[model samples]
Target: MEVLQMEVLQMMTPIEFWRAGFVFWTRAAEAQLEFASRWICAVGLSQRAAQTAAQKATIEALRAASVVPLAPNAISTPVPKRAARKAPRLAASRCRPTAH
Candidate 1:
């Protein structure tokens, strides 16, 4: 490119050379601005995702500590009868049968 630019340089007047340099730098600045805008957008998306995850985790942790289960059935079903829990049982007899 330098070799081609040297050939073009010989044909261009001093004023034309300055104008070409100005145009090249202007295009470079525009390209840099576009890249920066895209990078900032990507960073913003990831930041929002992290914030959403953090909020969900905090809410779940609070619910676990309080042991609250507020659902649609919270008002009617559990009001009269509380939710049943599974109780452990002990073996009363051996596995083999001794008599009929």
Candidate 2:
């Protein structure tokens, strides 16, 4: 990126506008705008959105994913039961227990 910028600066003859860096700067500006929009949305403009169409859609999607409902009323099919745990019985009376 630095090499491209240097090449662009070298090509600027001071008689005309440099075209190459213009493209690069435009893309960088667009990226900064997107980053700022995301930060604003995250900081709660999502609920008070009086902005772009894309921002409104993003807020709606956020709200939809946030809503949660409690326990299910019924199971469509029965779940299989797990096997019972076996007791860990030991014949330890035949030997002395270890001193912990």
Candidate 3:
């Protein structure tokens, strides 16, 4: 295959070579455009699907919330107060150094 391609490349005229390169590049450009368009379309579709899913989830959450009953004072529970901290006191005799 390599020998055959080398022979064909040797036989090709300068114009033919240029033409082949041009055709290959053009095809590549078209393929890239097609891939980009498909990728963009996929992204758009995914975004729309996510939005729809989020909306459905929100609606379901709202329905569930409505079905659940709230207890009285549930919204106004009193927070417990914390007692103030005090420093520990050592007796004078305890604080004094013991005799050696």
The candidate scoring highest on lDDT is 3
Ten contiguous residues minimizing lDDT sum, candidate 2: 67-76
lDDT of 3 by residue, 1-100 (tens): 9999999999999999877875665555555545554565567767556555444443444334443244543434776689989999998878978799
Per-residue CA lDDT of model 2 for 24-79, tens digit only, reads: 55555555556657777777676345246344444443334332231232222466
Q: How does model 2 score by TM-score?
A: 0.32
Task: Report clashes for each candidate as comma-separated counts.
Answer: 0, 0, 0
For all the candidates, what are their Cα RMSDs to the real structure?
23.0, 16.7, 23.0
Q: What C-alpha lDDT values do all the predictions have?
A: 0.57, 0.53, 0.60
Query: After aligning candidate 3 to the native by TM-score, how far in Å is the CA of 80 from where it should be?
Result: 71
State residue 94's C-alpha deviation in candidate 3, in Å: 99
Count residue pairs with overlapping backbones in model 3. Answer: 0
Q: Which ten residues in a row have the lowest lDDT in candidate 1?
A: 58-67
What lDDT score is found at residue 12 in candidate 1? 99
> What tens-digit string does per-residue lDDT give for candidate 1 at 1-100?
9999899999999999877765665555545545554555567756555555444443444344343444634433645667799786646674465696
